[model samples]
Target chain A: MTYTITQISIFAENRPGRLAAIAEALESENINILAFSIAEASGFGVIRALVDDPERAFKKLSSLGYVVSTTEVIGIKMHDRPGGLREISRMLGDAGINIEYAYAYTGRPNAVLIIRVDHVDEAINAILSKGGQLIQRTELA
Target chain B: MKYLDPRIEEMPRTEIEALQFKLLKTLVYRLYSFSDFYRSRMKEHNVHPDDIRSLDDIVKLPFMYKKDLRDNYPDGMFIGGQEDLVRYHVSSGTTGKPTVVGYTHRDLENWAISVARGLTSIGLGRRDVLQVSYGYGLFTGGLGLHYGAERMGATVVPASVGNTERQIELIQDLRVTAIACTPSYMLHLSEVAEKMGVSFERDTRLRTAVLGAEPWSEKMRARIEGSTGIKAYDIYGTSELSGPLFTECSEQNGIHIWGDLAYVEVIDPETGERLGPGEKGELVITMLQKEALPMMRYRIGDITSFEDSVCGCGRSHVRISRIQGRVDDMLIIRGINVFPSQIEHALMSVPELGEHFQIVVDRKGALDTMLVRVELKSAQLFSDKLDDLIRLKNKVAHQLRNNLNVAVDVELVSPETLTRFEGKAKRVIDRRVL
Candidate 1:
């Protein structure tokens, strides 16, 4: 099954009250966030949100002085059985594309993995080149 | 022998202008034959190659602004190719694009002479150990003063900016005799020196300071001297015009314009009428002796005055008053003209605030509310001093009203709230519905 879902990404400084400001911006845009995760480094932080409307969320955060970026991630549907994670990693490793970081969670029947890599275009190319099926959020939901 | 020295720091006016005329004639023919940019600009203004016989005819040529230099960026406006150029310097753009200034071998020599003249004006010579605090890399201040100090045969200590502790250590350890940087930075060092309980006057060997790259006040000059325990002299020049074109002499009356290189004029900023002695206006400069990128007439956008009064130092070259402010920095708020520097002047009077602050302009309900965010010194930050803060805010508002003729909201922040910059502080933040 093919799935189409919106991705929301908010860029914020790793400072107090900054996260609240981003939340307020998204709330004002009237976009309902379905799933969200926040990853932070020393100086900067990125809050990735799977929202109902990505375009509105992007524009609102930008207007509120938050640097926002959006990216499409394929929510691959793999069996909840063990060794499925190894299969995906082995495939990406053989392709010579390094994974910077990855966040994973379970949604009922299938496991969902959010992978951030060194180069988005290169990773996408590698995944497509390997003939791996890309799963969308709509298909999982 | 005196006339042959490029460092004509002590030359009389008649001799300097005589040299200026001779150089101008040679420069005019060179521009006509070599630089298409200068020749076309001159021809467009009906300024003939021969019509620029004397310095007075310089007014006939159109004044070159930073915009003209920026329009032909990188290498288009330059007379020589990249291979012929030795170095390039860029200005900190406050209004428009940062201007890239190039220097050839001859240009470098001319710049060195100008800087030596500046150092000599402040009584610096071979015996002095010059501690240069200006940052290097594309900034003309660092390398400009560096080469000039070296040319004067002085012991050069190239201590680029930052690391306050190291700067203080070198000041004491190396026995540095003089410091050069922006005047505001010298004030910063003075404050730091005080906090560390390092006696700048007693422990260090600093005698004189050359401060420029920003227009400061006599009040600031007194503060710098009082704090640092050294006589401070202003070095005036722009990257567009080779750096350090004017320097104050021993008399310390006004800055002596290098009459041989650039013809200086003070014109009414609005009406463009040439002003007489002691009248402040936009400073206009004409490059009298330049080969590579000779600018005929250039409007500096700085407000200044001309004083023909004779100096005790005996240099008859015209003296320009301390630069008041820049026309480009002037902003209109509800039909009232205001400069961020005006706010700075008013804020400095408070004594409780540090020099670092930003003027934020934003629209509130169809009306403009100009907010001045000031960083208060540590001594003024007491929980019990709410009344003091209120009083300080009122005093700044009163000063702004009396001086700028406009109402501004003053916000007092803790020390180091506003960001400190390495060069040219971003003092103004305009968010006025634009």
Candidate 2:
């Protein structure tokens, strides 16, 4: 199995200025947001971000009284061209792996697609054994 | 360290009891001889004032209730005529007709003395400036604390509840050192002050607050003290007892009920049998010196207990624990007695939970069920993992079970969903009768 990436999920109320506050906190600590996604829940939302420094970001945000924690998610490096995305998608699909949620950000030469799947170890095997590229945590920094 | 009335306040317990019995005997004779209401109540109970030889024999007297005041209406139970009355304060009843309480010169003086002792206990003195933020008019709070603050030689600012900006102005301009208001009002004032860019710790001179009139938990007190950076002491009394009186001293353990002015007892609400010290039960009070409105063993209906041990403040008065919910708010959930205040006390202990909560009780099949729906604090205190959220729910349930001795289900709701009350917060919805 390949390696897993750490993502910070902030439990925030669905109100104005909350996202700004989170971004301001991250900026104050000089933590760069590599990639992030926001998901809406019942009257609350989660802002999952892949920052340059997950450990520092977690401590800073939590210290500012924001509900924050880190979770292990898989970031797959896929082809930059169209239909190149099919290479990793088909490998996981044919292997009977389910993609719970996925979002992509442009990396140099290729795109690093962050996908949280139900089965972590199996998804890592399905991708890595098939010669798929896995982005290291240092590569994001 | 100085007492408002040291002679009686610092007396020994035996001496305090002697004074109480003497005052009780005098009050009973006055009630039986002057008022028609007490004369018939004693006759109806077949008990005479002559039978009361000792303090413990107070049980021989019939218990008075809020109902008695309502039934008597205006001046029916008063000991003196309108010519003898100096002031009148009517309590607005939520259920029935309002209760009119008249106070003669002596009655008003005793009321102020009660407040004077209470303010002194909270570490306030003539050097401090007091803002009476309670509502004036028919409400006893404003005028009661007003007179008390004057008697204690403090500069008085009759703010009287409203105009938040002006209240803040007075607090800053007058350099008010203390305030007497309801607990909710204190929270509201702090909020308003924050909006006006005023800091309680830096801008204002408020060092202490005597908050009461509403059922507030210790956690709430901690929140107020934490937020305002002031010592928040609990002052407890009803308009029926002559406004806000008997506050927690600097120790902030319990309220010091002056043994000379009134005698307090904890009685079983169901059986009227007196419970020993430290046992939780309904509180019954007898006004030993009230002139215009002579109340004898008035059933207060507030559930609490008292300790006869002298307070650390050096007063020999009995101090009762903060008022747990009123008797009417008690619910028998799963055959276990529960009060909403107990649930509030349990929930407020967790800083993550908001002050608002709703208790919903219903019967599922043949078994009874209870559910508590609470919101998160507005600023934050949330969780991302389902397991972490579940752990919080379990912890809250455990606290509730420990306090109420009944199984309860907890649900974490979103902020701004629960209703916020300006006066009294109604937190229970029992749907079991259907």
Which one wins on DockQ?
A: 2
How many clashes show up per model? Answer: 0, 0
Q: Write the per-residue lDDT of candidate 1 for residues B364-422, one digit (tens) a residue.
A: 63245688877655433222222344666688778766666557777655444468888
Tens-digit per-residue lDDT, B326-386, candidate 2: 6777665532346686788889888878788999987664245899988766546444555
Instruction: Evaluate all candidate structures by whole-model CA lDDT and list the values in order.
Output: 0.71, 0.82
Misplaced by over 4 Å in model 1 are A1-141, B1-12, B80-84, B91-98, B330-427, B430-434
Candidate 1: RMSD over Cα atoms?
14.6
Which candidate number has the best lDDT? 2
Off by over 4 Å in 2: A1-141, B329-434
TM-scores, all models, native as reference: 0.61, 0.59
